[model samples]
Target: MREHRGVPPILTVVAILVLGLTLSATAPAAVAAPTGKPGDVVRSTEITDRPEARMASAARVFDVTYLSADPRGRLVEVKGSVSLPKKAPGPGGWRILAWNHSTMGLGDSCTITDSLGKDKRGSRDKWLGQWLRDDYVIAATEYQGIGGPGVHAYLDGPVAGKNTLDMVRAARTVVKKYVGTDTSNAFVSFGGSQGGHASMWSNSLAKSYAPELKNAATIAHSVPTGLSDYFAAIRPGFPNVVVPDYVTYFSYVLAGLKVSRPDIDVDSYLTPLGRTVIKNAQRLCYAESGPATKGLTVGQLVSRPLADGPLLPALRQYTRLPTSGYGAPILLQQGYLDVVAFTPLTGQFVSRLRSNGVNVTYRTYPTQLHGLSTAQTLEAVKWANTRTTWPR
Candidate 1:
């Protein structure tokens, strides 16, 4: 028995020890990968290098789409990505934060990703991304038509809100496979510019649309609420950047309200220049289009006595506000020097929401202009983290 008491079989002991440790380490990684998956996720990275892919990657690098029902109660689709804080708990265990991208419809399919690969600063804009890093799952939507099958409704609140709420459901759907329960987590909404409007409107419409997931806090930066007010403020300066925006507005109104007003002569309503401008405007941000369309004169687009015109009145009717109030804790960041989204209109919308008894907090940035204003993501995170349940 060659002294078998001591090192009888070193190889046997090594194999047993190695197998046990390997199993222990690999098991947890697998479970956590599925359940506690980080929110900074994307469907694929192969498309990331292409020009179009680069753009989408730039805007929302972590592009993850999930299945959720549309407002019509049908199984519709949504495209977006989630950003979870490092060392953060899973969605149900911790807070879930959802973000809405500004303009470019729901899917604008804009080429910005969460990775900040292109611009170095990228879409996560320093202040905005830092605030988003607190303790939440930030999900940004590409809205309808921007990336997917349907046409983007632009400022259509009901449709936009429906899409936004559905995105939460979509995210929860993905999260539940790992966490088991859907309603165990809390959610907050945040966005700026057009996103600001969507954030507020979606907050208002969430109670009725998807009452399960409560809205913790909503932050808006110079939100455009009242179409009437927006028009009133800029009508006098139509020849400036406002005219092309007006054209774009009418185009969106036509597209969103097409079902309600089928009689609209979509082609006749658009001038060759209006059509061209609107076509190009759809791809640009407020800042880009503002300066791009500066050359167009007002009289060329809309005639005098704008009220009775074929397009002006129709546009006015399409963008009018509904009487419903957005019920959510809100933080509004208004840029006093914002020329694109007139400050007065944002104030009026805030007034309307506040008067309706909605929980709201409004802040104004006296010197910041439209392009220069930070997304104000810090306040949104702080406000959202305070909510215990949904609809905070």
Candidate 2:
């Protein structure tokens, strides 16, 4: 009697079938497995088929997303570019040049790859072209967070060092796929400004972090070794008038430290206007942010003097140069006339390195500005090439 009141068997069957189909369509998809170990290529796309006329020797260029790690060893995705030589690899394979770029900004838009050949400064293009012409495979890291997720870690030495080393590991994958499997395990690290900091850190980290990498040598130019010294040097004159560019640089350092050290409250030390400008600067590239802070003095930017704030201690911790643990020879290049990374401070850092038993070849360029150290590109390439071949 109860069944008689219910729907007929045929209709009941149809309803059951419809419900099953809907469930199947709405079911959650299975999660994908982790790709592989660090240095594994997550994916790569050929962004450019031919190089710029200036890079005639470069066969192809690729934009790559690869697996790396943050300072805490959490898995992170890093984006970078690789340029292969037009000529085929020799029996010994191609040697790698890991180019750690200087400070562009703390934003994703500041990724060096975005303006590889089109940089208004043209310095990068010229430098890279020269490397390619010399038949060295160039692998340039945009650095963690520059074109990837999270905040650009600015001057965090370990993070920068790891990114530099991981780029070389990822470059090996590219070489095996496109160039040849005969690629040399030997590589060199070099950079200037923030990049110089990274280059030094990479060499220091190589033995501990990536023992497999044959880091032949390291070259750092116009290096910013200590932020505390830099801050003291750049403090406003007696009149208290500061270059607006200094304000922009300060903003980058603050923003970077905020991300890397989330436990510290960066906003507590800033004035309301300082907080506003920093927030705006976070979204801008280096070019835009520099001008935005122009004409603003130190007193106008912050409520309390930077030296009196909690930032100094943190800066001191983050700004120290690695005194030991680097295995390769180092070439430190400084500019006598460079006010940005003042010559005197750099000289002191070199002295400390030497005292620590570091084999440092210090070269000072007279009558040159901060950017002039990069003009040693050709000489550095030769230095690295010779070291890789001679191994002394």
Candidate 3:
């Protein structure tokens, strides 16, 4: 946790950090509330100067409250973290590495930034630390509702995309103003699992939503694509017992969908016991919720199959990746043995992207599992670096 030479002391900056400010009277009614265009910082707090164990090369860490929109255009306050490297920015400024995190939980405490002060190291830290050493500013989103007001929008791609894109903008603003670390608008997006889904969405939506982040590269590892097929593979009707231990993930998805899509009633898809399980899920994070649903078969969880229900169309619409309009280079990595995202589905997804005229690089590992795919960090980092540094 060594401090850099020119950075301000942790305590001094934290003490004087700005709090909430009132909205201006002359602001337009559309954005007259606490909201503004995406990435506008409502407030910023210098959380710490001492690098956390997971962030070994961080010179300064700040918790930022910024503006982002939901799918329907409602303004919401989103919280995320920005970590600057110890080395000073170059003449053009430090480039950004936006890290969208995997599913932790639907609860507020599941925020990845909350892990900053702990002594333990996260699995991604080894590679994330590598990026820090290479002098990249890391900006991570806690997603929509993890540390903010609304319910966590688990797999909703557009919402997560907007949040991820805005995080980079907020990180640049906060670091330049407070830590004196100049940051370039150039950036790369990377994530796995739910994060992987967000990464693809961010790249797909960048042209229309945030054109400022042009030429950004994306790395999606162990991405869960082909949502309709995924649901069918895990349903109880499958030949053998499938995903007995992972039913909890579906529970969270159901709960999250209920939050985002008000017209769909979650109770309609669940049995009496399923209702109780989902109720309990709303209170706990992933660790607790996963174990809570262990040994509970999919049949017991739902009265009727999701495939037969009216919810299928909506589920397909939200969960599937956009077929085209990706404006940047994409690199997809999948593990052969991954049951969660499934290897064949990822292959199919790559095919679709290629068919749509996207420039995609696909890689598969033989012995890697869902989580082990994260070990590809070094290669992924190098790929992103090359793209971001490429001439516009």
The candidate maximizing lDDT is: 3
lDDT of 3 by residue, 192-253 (tens): 88999999999988888877766479988888788666565444343335643466777777
lDDT of each: 0.55, 0.76, 0.77
The total number of steric clashes, by the backbone 3 Å criterion, in model 3 comes to 0
Error of 3 at 292 (Å): 1.1
Clashes within 3 Å, all models in order: 32, 0, 0
Give the CA lDDT, 0 to 100, for residue 305 in model 2. 52
Lowest-lDDT window of 10 residues in candidate 1? 31-40
lDDT string, candidate 1, 170-265, tens digits: 566554443354433456777776677667767877777677767767777756655654444333236444433654454444445443344554
Ranking by TM-score: 3, 2, 1
Ordered from best to worst lDDT, the candidate numbers read: 3, 2, 1
For model 2, the local distance difference test gives 0.76
Top of the candidates by TM-score: 3
- True-structure lDDT of candidate 3: 0.77
- Tens-digit lDDT string for candidate 2 (1-392): 01245688899899899998997899787656446777888888776653432244467788888877774667678889888877777777777888888778878777775346654566665666677776677888988887887777678888888888888999889878865565678788888889999999999989888887888889889888667755543332313533337777777887777777776677766777778787776667889986787767555656655576567778777766788777889988887888778888888888888898998888887887776534577677777666555222
Question: In candidate 2, where is summed lDDT lowest over 10 consecutive residues?
Answer: 235-244
Residue 377 lDDT in candidate 3:
74
Instruction: Give the lDDT of residue 229 in candidate 3.
Output: 65
TM-score of each: 0.69, 0.85, 0.86
